[model samples]
Target: MFFKSSKINEFRLWGLLFTLFGMGLMILGTSGIVFWGQAGKWFAGVFMVIGMIAMLLSVGVYFWAGMLSTSAVILICPECNRHTKILGKTDRCMYCKTKLTLDPNEATDLDEGITEKA
Candidate 1:
């Protein structure tokens, strides 16, 4: 299924995944694999560095996404009657994928999100 959420939500998800991946790498580095035994200290240090980089990237992404969210507009979806955040004038409902727009004149039924009553 397609991702059903606001753009900001998508960005946050990616950042969170990055954080989890970093955590995984850190765990692997410290897991004490036999091959790493020869230079375990150096190996662990490298892994820790890589993991920290990933974690830092995640934090930056999260901060940027959150900052962008501050400018997003929250609108109530007509289809689902739910509050949805819209960025850059056009967006879909987070719950129902209903296409919405800041420009009312631009709304049309040809799109998937907007359903016209027959």
Candidate 2:
């Protein structure tokens, strides 16, 4: 069977995961409030703190992903001639299983090719 790929899949997955995490954190924070009324001070405080940390992390992840989406380089795959965005130190061609590079001079370094392994 042939496999088809979609653009923005990774970013969308990250976004969905982060959003779910944020929602979960909000639920936990609400639980913490309820616990504060029942459980002793220390436990409730800990729960609230942990929930807040989760929320902050989720937000940071979402913001960072947004920045990455904007900054990621778009490339037309030489193998398939399909357009795709490359992110970070490495990425993959969404259409073809061909290795790609962000820097032509550093192309020899498989490790340095931003789209070497994708």
Candidate 3:
């Protein structure tokens, strides 16, 4: 399953990855001091700035996901019979990982793809 998650979960996952990446970059920047002594100050500053940008991007993504979640349509997954939110015309059951879609054409397409892969 390349992307077998609800849209909201996917967004949050990406946000988390961005946060981790940003933190790693910041830690790497601080480590410059250990490797280059006084000259590392410039190196640290550059990386720290880049890290901050990544962190900000993550924040934006989180905010956007949050907003989308609030506006998303809530439905019960036929497979799982559990509540899940649909972000766009298509999404998946968060629990059962069933491909779900509001459009009939998309649903058939998804089914055909699944059958082909299986």
Ranking by TM-score: 3, 1, 2
lDDT of 1 by residue, 1-118 (tens): 1476777778889899999999998888886545667677777778888999999999999999989888888889998998888888777777888778888788775665555434
Provide the global lDDT of candidate 2 against the true structure.
0.62
lDDT of 3 by residue, 28-88 (tens): 9999988999999999999999999999999999999999999999999988899999988
RMSD of each: 3.8, 8.4, 4.3
List candidate 1 segments past 4 Å from native: 1-4, 33-35, 104-106, 110-118
Residue pair clashes in candidate 1: none
lDDT of model 3 at residue 91?
A: 89
On the 0 to 100 scale, the lDDT of residue 4 in model 2 is 29
Put down candidate 2 lDDT per residue, 36-57, tens digits, no spaces.
Answer: 6655455656656666666677
Q: Is 1 or 3 the stronger prediction by lDDT? A: 3
Q: How well does model 3 score by local distance difference test?
A: 0.89
Instruction: Return whichever of 1 and 2 wins on TM-score.
Output: 1
Best TM-score goes to which candidate? 3
- The TM-scores, one per candidate, come to 0.78, 0.49, 0.85
